[model samples]
Target: MSTTADRTPTRHTAGVFDIRTIIGTLLGIYGIILTAMGLLGDPAYDRTGGVNANLIAGIALLVAGLVFLAWAKARPVVVDERELARGDDGNAVHEAR
Candidate 1:
């Protein structure tokens, strides 16, 4: 006799393993580093026509990273334990033959 809880699907979020999360984290880290360099380090205006490339790029990366993180937070990937357990076996083709 299965209870209501037992019949319900066991689901969980992809968490840190999600691609968006990984990308967001990496971008955010790099953004911070670049932004710091642009602010404190020497900004050679000669190479980029007086434009602070590091600062501009860092800000852009930060914004993109935030967007990705927000997207992942808003719509997380859910995984069902039942589905994972029911994954196809390698012998399926052999059996069908």
Candidate 2:
């Protein structure tokens, strides 16, 4: 006996990992670091010698990451029935009625 899956069609989809995704990931990481600095200790500035660049940078990264994440989530992912049934060689045949 054979599975109907063998008769079904298969489809392959390429992964999506573009510059935006990379940038978003990097920014998110930076945001975490900045947030940590903001919590741990004070930041240093060139003029005032007490600037919280870390906090600012962290916020920026967090925001950027969020935006990219949103975009990524918005993308749709689809799988055809044929693909799912490709390997199922079960009783799929119908008698002439």
81: Cα error in model 2, Å: 15
Candidate 1, run of 10 with poorest lDDT: 88-97
Cα lDDT tens digits, model 1, 1-97, are: 9999989978788889889899999999999998998999889899989999999999999999999999888888877767677776432111111
Query: lDDT score, residue 48, model 1?
Result: 86
* RMSD (Å) of each candidate, 1 decimal: 7.1, 10.8
The superposed Cα distance between candidate 2 and the true structure at residue 79, in angstroms, equals: 11
Error of model 1, residue 50, in angstroms = 1.0
lDDT of 1 at 11: 78
- Where model 1 places Cα greater than 4 Å from the true spot, the runs are 89-97
How does model 2 score by TM-score?
0.52
